[model samples]
Structure formats: structure tokens, C-alpha cells
Target: MPNAAERPRRIRVQRDGPLIVEGPVEVVGEDGEVTVSHRFTVAVCTCRRSQIYPWCDTSHRRRRDRRSGPPGGEAG
Candidate 1:
């Protein structure tokens, strides 16, 4: 039987950005370097803009994000 806790997780794509993963992982870069990291969460690049490649550096936030409301100078 496969160990449920040892299985690699598949990243899921959010509505606006790269896929988010939160389980066991084994990642390999194009240069053939491999790394295994365990965390409560992880993010994989989808837009291919990451300098580190395949990782989210929060760069996508600028392309897909904008405030929906007006300036808050008078909201107080």
C-alpha cells in the first residue's frame, strides 16, 4: 500500500495565479538540480516569469491585482 503521508502533492491553480501546493514534494529544475522540501504550503510558477523559475516571488500580484475601490483619503 502507498503511504498517504509520503505521496507527492499536485499543485492546484488558483483563480488568478500559479498553482499552490501543500504536501510532500520532489522538484527538479531544467538544469537537473533537485530539491525536496516539506512545508505547510508551497507555490509553483505558472506565468514563467520567476527568476528562480517554478517558484512564486509574488511578481504575479502586480499583473493580476488592483484595488477595486476608490482612494481611501476620505473613507475615515
Candidate 2:
């Protein structure tokens, strides 16, 4: 097994989506507040629309579908 210090943390990025990171992870907000997750993997929000800040709740997907407009590029 690789030593914890020698192992690199993996993070997966998605276009218009959350960043998938290997955990357990700690996130510090602008206010100096810390958010911690102990899951095997975690989704960090990037679009800032998640009901649960820092942790993604797939809110970006909902917004993307709405902004794509209807068929033939017409938005009503």
C-alpha cells in the first residue's frame, strides 16, 4: 500500500458540473468555516446553486437543462 504522504489525491473535473474528489476531505469557506466529508468520494459544487453549499447536490444539472433552450434553439 502506498504511504498516505506519497499517495496523490485524485480529483475529477466535469464540464458544467461538480468536481469529484477522493475523500475524506476538508473544505474551508471564505468565512473560515470548515466543511468536512468522510465519504469515499465527494462532489464539490462549482456553480454555487446547490442547496448544500460546498457539497454538490446535482443542482448544476437542473440549471443546465433549463438554459439549453427547447428544440430548434427556440426558448419560450
Candidate 3:
């Protein structure tokens, strides 16, 4: 097995937040348009409520509905 430093970057899925990833990254839209980010790290939103699609801006942290939990909710 490779050492920790040699391992590839990971995607961390937050139950109530963004999908954390190492950048620079490109997210291609269905319309054949590509959104690019060049930061050292990126937060890809899972919640459909983001004002900025693909990239996260902490919109998931709000309480939109009482019936709802986190964006994707907790994983067993």
C-alpha cells in the first residue's frame, strides 16, 4: 500500500454541507458549459438550494424547512 502522502486526493461528503474536494476542478453543466475553479480546495454543493451551483457558499447551513434535516442527511 502507498503511504498517506502518496494517496490520491479525496472527496469528503458532508451531511449538511458541501462536497469537499481538492482543486483546481471543472464542473460541466448539462448544457455543455463548463465551470472551472482554481482554488487549492473546493466545496461542491450537494444541496439544491445553493445560489451558486456546483460551488458551495454555505447555503446548506440555513434552516429552510423544519421537516428537513441536513442536505443529504446522516449516513448510517
Candidate 4:
């Protein structure tokens, strides 16, 4: 078996927050557009209203709607 230190990256679900992703991950938009990014940390956009795209900018704090997936491109 491989050592834990050499394990591959994976995605972890946060109890009430964005999905915690490690290692390699791909992100796509509503139009099926793909984004390329390389970083240690990122908060994905679950509300689908973030102008920043695949990343979360905490816009969900004020969104009246909290539906998963997409919200017809509406911020709230």
C-alpha cells in the first residue's frame, strides 16, 4: 500500500460550506465552459451568482435563494 503522505488529492464536503478540494479538480460553468486554475485553496460558487465564476466570493451570505446546482444565473 502507498503511504498516506503520497496519497492523491480528493474532494471533501463541508458541513455547511463550499466543497473542500485538494489535488486536481476541474470546474465548469452553466454554459459548459471550463476554467483553468492552480491554487492551494478556493471556495467554489454553489449559488451560481458569483461574478468571479467558479470561485466563491461569499455572495451567498445575502442570497435569498440557496438552491444547489444553478440558480438561472441569478445572484440571489
Name the top TM-score candidate: 2
lDDT of each: 0.62, 0.79, 0.74, 0.60
Superpose all Cα atoms of candidate 1 onto the true structure and report the RMSD in Å to 1 decimal: 6.8
Candidate 2 on 1-76: residue-level lDDT in tens? 2236358889998877789999888888999998988898999998899999899997776665655765334321
lDDT for predicted candidate 4 compared with the true structure: 0.60
Per-model tally of clashing residue pairs: 0, 0, 0, 0
Q: Which stretches of candidate 1 lie over 4 Å from their true place?
A: 1-10, 64-76
Estimate TM-scores for all models.
0.56, 0.77, 0.69, 0.55
Candidate 1 lDDT, 1-76, residue by residue in tens:
1337756666677754667888455567888886665666778777777676677776655554245334332211
Query: On lDDT, who's better, 3 or 4?
Result: 3
Model 3 C-alpha lDDT per residue in residues 1-76, reported as the tens digit of each score: 1224455777887766788988777777879888988788999988867788888877766745667765456431
Q: Give lDDT: candidate 1, residue 45.
A: 74
RMSD of each: 6.8, 5.7, 6.4, 8.3
Give the poorly placed runs of model 3, Cα more than 4 Å off: 1-7, 67-76
User: On lDDT, who's better, 2 or 3?
Assistant: 2
Question: What is the descending lDDT order?
Answer: 2, 3, 1, 4
Could you tell me the lDDT of residue 42 within candidate 4? 59
